[model samples]
Target: MWPGGTVRDVAGLWDVALPAEAVRVPGVSMAGFRSRTDRFVDMQVVPYPALTLFVDFGDGRVVDDAGSRWMDSGVVGLAPGGARGRGRSIDCLQVRISPLVAHAVFGAGAEFSGAMVSLEELWGREAVRTRERMWEAGSWQERFAVAREMLLRGQSEGPAVDPEVAHAWRQMVRQQGRVRVAGLAEETGWSRKRLWSRFRSQVGLTPKRAAQLVRFDHAAHRLAAGEQSASVAATSGYVDQSHLHREVRAFTGVTPNAVAQAQWLDVDDVAWGRGRAGARRLRVG
Candidate 1:
């Protein structure tokens, strides 16, 4: 047994640990990964519909193909395209927070539209301290506890989004991004222009773009699960199979078939639970 809890070790590639369900906070999910050997780590990171936070605890460094590097920890924003992580001996706690909750946890002014930022830029010295604390923890469960405490504190202290904005986002998730922005505006009792501007400022994506992203994420996962492009397109609010292909290409710079075979998505069932409604999980291969 591990110090705090038993970790599910998978084929010795990496050790994956999850928090107890009782301790799981709403709107937040996290998984801990520790490399079992010194092999080189290289993998594609598929975009998901949540704000991603990485808390690093290993000696190795992870850098993307685009020249951006995170030696310690960092945050990845919405729709960060074509970024692949390359490293060795990787160890980190990966947290996925819903944009609705993230807006409050990171504050309204935080930029996450389509960028990767060092944790220091947003959390300053606190980021370093948090990393140190997690590294010092006895086990993955302890580390998850520390991270959960931090998120709870941040969410409690941060500014909240408008209730209408939260409602719209929930609706999008509930409907798998098939809802209309104009309909959301009417439901929220706000004008289209007002809702559009507010959502952009608060969530870092326009309502329409956010809907598209949600739709894309759902479709991508479906493809990853071996569903045909035509079927996914038909059910995921796309105009046609061609539309699905184009969207997969636009968001990931790859075809739907390529996305289906992406290694990054291989762990979703274990980490996020398969077919759980509204589970926003991040995938870094």
Candidate 2:
């Protein structure tokens, strides 16, 4: 069974938190996850609103559903939001970088949408050097400082995303993905076709898909909080409980009940329990 504020099974458990510098970067938040023991995290990755970067500093390896890539120490794995993977005896610092900030940092936000690639592919050998530095750092605070400097330097080099795309994305996030695409077009003074073309080009997912992801993220956490599925469905803009189920399944390949007990969501309370956004905890029996 799952314990409060932690995700555990045969794979063991992890402790998580956000560093102080994480708050200064817009569209960037870092969650430090340290394994309680040498173990694995086997679960479908619950999609989030940002690019997930794992800076591994532990023993063993991590593999995802899509391929045979085994991410080990001195390796940096990049899973675009929504990509699922597996971790075996993993201990690392996980950073969630919003796609909005991604373009400015990685210089290629559109390339990562719905895909998983190693940070080495994008950052090249710099990925190797950074991982080495992280491992050498004496403490989490020093490690976090190294990470912040690298990202901030990268952020200084690239062009920003279009203001229109930023505005549309902001609306989708603010409404918890409940807003209509046509309304976004109208508000941006762009035709529906134009909005669709541009949003997809820059943001990766189409406007509709992005909104669905945002909605599912909010509802998944609510369900984990022990809210009844039917109640969550009604308030989450679903036509019915079945609609919520289908969406949840589509996003995570799991039932609403399973998502409520997901190890991925369970760790949020402990790892992200405090810091920039404060703590979000839910009791699970």
Number of the predicted model whose TM-score against the real structure is largest:
1
Candidate 2 residue-wise lDDT at 123: 80
lDDT (tens digit, per residue) of candidate 2 on 65-135: 55555565322222233344355545567777776777777765445576666768778888888888888
Candidate 2: segments with Cα more than 4 A from true spot? 1-12, 21-24, 73-88, 273-285
Q: Whole-model lDDT, candidate 2?
A: 0.68
Count of clashes, each model:
0, 4
- Model 1 segments beyond 4 Å from truth? 59-65, 108-110, 275-285
lDDT (Cα, tens digit) per residue for candidate 1, span 104-197:
7776333667677787888899988988888788877888888888889998998888999999999998998999999999999999999998
Alpha-carbon deviation at 214 in model 2, angstroms: 0.3
How well does candidate 1 score on lDDT at residue 115? 77
lDDT values for all models: 0.78, 0.68
Report RMSD for candidate 1: 3.5
TM-scores for every candidate against the unseen true structure: 0.91, 0.84
In candidate 2 the C-alpha lDDT for residue 97 amounts to 78
